[model samples]
Target chain A: MLWEKEMRVPNTAVVDGKTYATVLGMVRDDRFIPLELVYKPKPGDNVVGIVTNVRHAGYSIELNLPYDGFISSKFTRVSFQQGDLIYGRVKFVDEVGNADITDAKRLPAGKIVDVPASKVPRIIGKKSSMLNVIRDGTGCSIFVGNNGYIWIGGKGNLPLALKTINFIVANAHKHGLTDKVAEYLNEHGGDVKVPPREEEKPPEEKSGLSEPAEETPEPAKEPETAEPSEPSEGEPVSEKEEKDAGSSEEEKQNPIMHSKSAGAAEESGEVKKKGIDIEEM
Target chain B: MEKPELIKDGKRLDGRTPKDLRPVKIEAGVLKEAQGSALVEWGGNKVLAGVYGPRECIPKHGADPYKAKLKIRYTMAPFCSKGEHSRSGPNRRSIEISKVIREAFEPVVLSSQFPRSQIEVYIEVVQAEGGTRVASLTAAAVALADAGIPMSDMVSAIAVGKINGQLVVDLGKDEDNYGESDVPMAVTHRDKQIVLMQMDGLLTREELAQNIDEAIEASEKVYELQADALKKSYEKEERGKLKL
Candidate 1:
């Protein structure tokens, strides 16, 4: 049967004289099953957004959320055309869920897939260890958004990486998810190794949520390792993979590596305090 | 034209009873490029529906600032009909069906959710026995759902008609050519809200009410079949999961 409108049983909140139907545990209803997942972005969170609408002033980005977030004019210095993928930080998130972003860097060539929004934390895993395993195994540069959109970029093991990641997303509700993903990665990830991440120095800090991508660079990108993207072939990168590296000029600006080049322990503590790891909501 | 025998011993021309619907087979996710696609075979009718976009709206000016605009094309193949030799282009009948079908869907779709975008549904009648619109509407809803377009509910449809002075459900080609009346109807499967209703030929006021009521109830079966087709699409992915 088509679902009738749910009975609003008194649980609501009034913010600025506007009342919203807010249920506990992010439940659609206490009486009925949950049908939709609403993603809320906190400050310092990383999101991969697709540029949905563009104008001379700025752009509107779709973050797998219902409403599009705006990247205003001043931040438009880094030119982003419509349909470009932006690896941005959530700068200003309001009670009404509207967002204003800053330092919106673009993601290079990659395949993007969306999973159920609530399943996002499971993909990130505990302290991002599951994410590390997937990244290390496949030799793909991976970035996951709080909005449940995942971007994977690299060479050779793409299709297999996509299959394994989607599996984790699908079966996340089940327990022992990390172990299963690790096992799958170990068994099918092949013999290649990920090169260490290069922590190029950061530009002057701009705002509170400046450079979450850099602050939380994946463990796969280390400076000491010899070029993480290629383990087997010492050949030139494909045109597509090369386009993914951003303009060579911007490489000096170094968008994704933070000033804090210490190590993984620092990365784990910072992300945890930020309350990034997904929890059932 | 000879009025072919439509019912004998309370059986339809296809040897089914008046209340018996034609065998219908629906499959979802049939086309690769379309966001969602479905093919439905009801009786002798074959209808394929493909849904694309909620992407960008084209022609610039046609883009609605408040809601997604709908672009619908309901067409019949030149050789879809038997003996009569149907034409390839849009006719008065197809145009009317297209308009009503669009109106039927616009109410339930939450188009305002995707502003300045266009969602297009193309329904192609590959084989036409009768009740092409009903079959098309059924397939279109499945394709739209499979496309992950947000909707209030999926709609299912069927045709009710009078054949040989007896009320019948889902008329066959020969039965329709010889039948007295055809009433095509669709309802929101979740709310049972009547979305599309049209009558042709003639029916008593009492027969019209009764047939419309009966057809709505009979649509429950069609709704179940539609759900089964969508579920079957995901079932095929299990092997892909296990293989990994």
Candidate 2:
């Protein structure tokens, strides 16, 4: 009873006729999983976190991670507060253990938000351009982390910023999103700068069993070749991907028909033309 | 009352062989509002699994400061079966099944990762034939994964039983009524660890081992379906094809 494929756990290699599970390195341990599924903090990566606990030493923050992180008073200029949202950098990952936050700043007057970890890049735009749009338009300073935690700070445009970011987070998967976000920003605040058109840069991360197929394939078929090798390597794997892709196309054509994205459907009930048949819980 | 002959020659009542399983289909992200959900149709059973939370524990007291807690509820809809609508709420049998379901998943979920938070699972048996528990467990596993909860493996379950003195795989409702022994087994595939096992009626040592082996084999197929459903979900989400 051995699973050859998933047995990355050296701990599970049979010893004395017993299987002992191993907690492999959280990073690069289960290479099969997309990077979004595993949490690994790199030095200087921006992070947004909520203060889950306030200690005499400092505050423990939640980055939507398994472990609460500590932002030590070592570098804090202001007093730490509980339940407050903080934005900072991963200054150092004790790759030996948990990473410590440095240059931490509290965001007092704004909302802390979330998107699926996988969609963080989409919200951050092609290269922080999307994030910059939301920031400049709403006059909010936004920080997005690999964990999908977002800290949005602003007074004049706090509400607008939250709405815009929420929209982007909710509909991050849709195309023509940069235009949509820019349009919404301009309509709400005549002063906010709206970019005419955004350059859609397919990320450089699309190597290996990467997302080039699903992420950019909708608009262009050129990326299709990048994934053919993947499809051929494991025929069954590609077959499932094809079936899912087919079903997704079916849903897009008839969104109101059945099978809506859970995030979009959960946002509001009034969006439906038939309206009010299904009440929000 | 004449007993239904569960198997004739090699085929069962549904024309399935002794080792044949009921057809199973799974769809992930079936419910809105729930972080993750899935619907599974196996044989005549329709089960929906919904996952919510990893948020603050309600009642403010169910929190475990160190590890995320799991609450698994299994309910059989009142009209799930013929002629009789079950009363809503947790019955004794449902409670026991719920407990077992919780234990079945507790080992697989990376609950400790989200301390003091609770991830809840709601398994609604829209219809039940035989092996509703197994079907629901299968669906729950997918729903948990669909929710993007970290896990070592997805647990899959199937029931293999002795019907008309013949060991069979995936007993149907009719066969269950007349079956001499029924065993439901769940294993976390990556680990091949049996997380849940329950037996009803009787089996000798040798028969138990043999049937357990059959259950293990059947579970592998179940795992394939579960994995397929989960992968389909992420792929669909990736393509922005998800309606949400």
Candidate 3:
């Protein structure tokens, strides 16, 4: 019932009392499932890809999706060879999941980590919390693709970063994952600094219990406006209509009374003016 | 071969009652290279199903513009059966089984979600009993779900037949070989809509209809096993991560 108000999206289903995922994924809010089981490309995605083929006009980039991505020669400032690693942003996505990438640059010699595209958000964490811990603690410069490919470079601890990422992917569906990941990172000799998670919004919002409280006032107001419109439309009056009809009738009367009083005031003023004019005559 | 006792009293050759199904074990994500893979052991049948794509359709010409094409290959190994060595390759029987399996899955798989793509399912019968087609389909459905292919609902299958004049669910190889009639059926458990149904022998109209209901009823158990297997695979990985 809590997820019905907030987390219910395309890939989620409600069975009995619990929300179940229809796709092969952790029980995450459907909105956060930008990367589906198969990565469907969206515009403005920062992507890491392997350049599989370099044509005269463009490069065919493999982003781990079913369809390969194409980067036109005009979009890139420098030429890329086959097998070169490139990091870019998705510029366009067609009706199918094919992507046209832009702003691509060759990445340095480093390891490319592949994860399930759906788990990309977990690796990134809330507000990049996990990413910052991995980056700051291991001192690795990391570039993450929404398509589940991660590029790690610079002189940071790559193994630690990878282990932390793997751990995040494994337990992506668990609650309080950030703290557990922080503990794991610290235990593994990575000097990752974990920002205090307590500063974040409390557990009520995370558990989604607080959402209905925010939502209750919304439905209460809808019935009030709907009550007057129903009678005017000559539709059958239901129980809800009958319930709010009293307040709606009062609201209707107040507006009519204001108009009637204003009309009376104008008439009385005109009569007084006429009386004054006749007296003068 | 002499006619063996297919059923005695209320039990079949495998010592299962008329309503009992063979033990079904399923494991998901078994192959690293496949997008999704599953192994299903139903009775003596060992079926491995692997899924690839919603990727670009090969040969360009075979691609469907509006929906992803489903290519299914249901094959059995040469040494899968008991008697003589079976020949490997797409024989007429495997080809027919492949088509029916594909048709069974077509309505459930949300192929329209991916245009100009193809999802290939390879169901290899490592060992065969009587109900390899149903077992392969059971595994393929799991593999598709494990691969994250969008499906409206999980499809499950079972075989039912009249063995020794007694209606039984999930016929064994000997029972199927000697039974008067056999019906292999696949159904979407949520709606009980029969996606695949085949009859191999004669039956009364009432018996045919009743066997369909029996197969649909038996498929619910198969559906539960598939769901549990898919979840257990992930749960095992999660537990391993926690141990770390």
Which residue pairs in candidate 2 collide?
A66-B113, A260-B243, A260-B244, A261-B242, A261-B243, A261-B244, A262-B244, A264-B244, B78-B86
Task: In model 3, state the lDDT of residue B84.
Answer: 53
Output the chain A TM-score of model 1: 0.55
lDDT of 1 by residue, A1-281 (tens): 10123232222222233222221111211221111223445454567889988876788989865457879878657888888988776677654355677767888989887764445656665445556667777778787776667787877478777877778754543334554566576667543233132332111111122222232324223222222221111111111222222233123222211211111100012222122212210
Interface RMSD of 3: 25.7
* lDDT (10s digit) by residue, model 2, range B1-244: 7767878979889899988899999988778667678999999999999987676666567678767789999998998988355596798889999999999988777565556667889999999888999999999988876676656556899998898889999988878878889999997775578998999989999999999899999999998787666545533433222222
Model 3: how far is B109 from its true place, Å? 1.1
User: Which is superior by DockQ, 1 or 3?
Assistant: 3
| lDDT tens readout by residue for model 3, A1-281 | 21433233334444443333445543212231321276666665678999999898999999987679999998788799999998887788777668999878899988898877666766665455667777877888887887878888899888888788878776654434555666687889877555544322211012231222232222222111111122111111111222332343334323322221010000012222223222321
Q: lDDT for model 1, please.
A: 0.63
Error of 3 at A82 (Å): 3.0
Chain B fold agreement for model 2, TM-score? 0.94
lDDT of 3 at A3: 40
Best by DockQ: 3
| Deviating ranges (above 4 Å) for candidate 1 | A1-46, A49-56, A59-70, A76-85, A89-100, A108-130, A146-149, A154-159, A166-180, A191-281, B83-89, B238-244
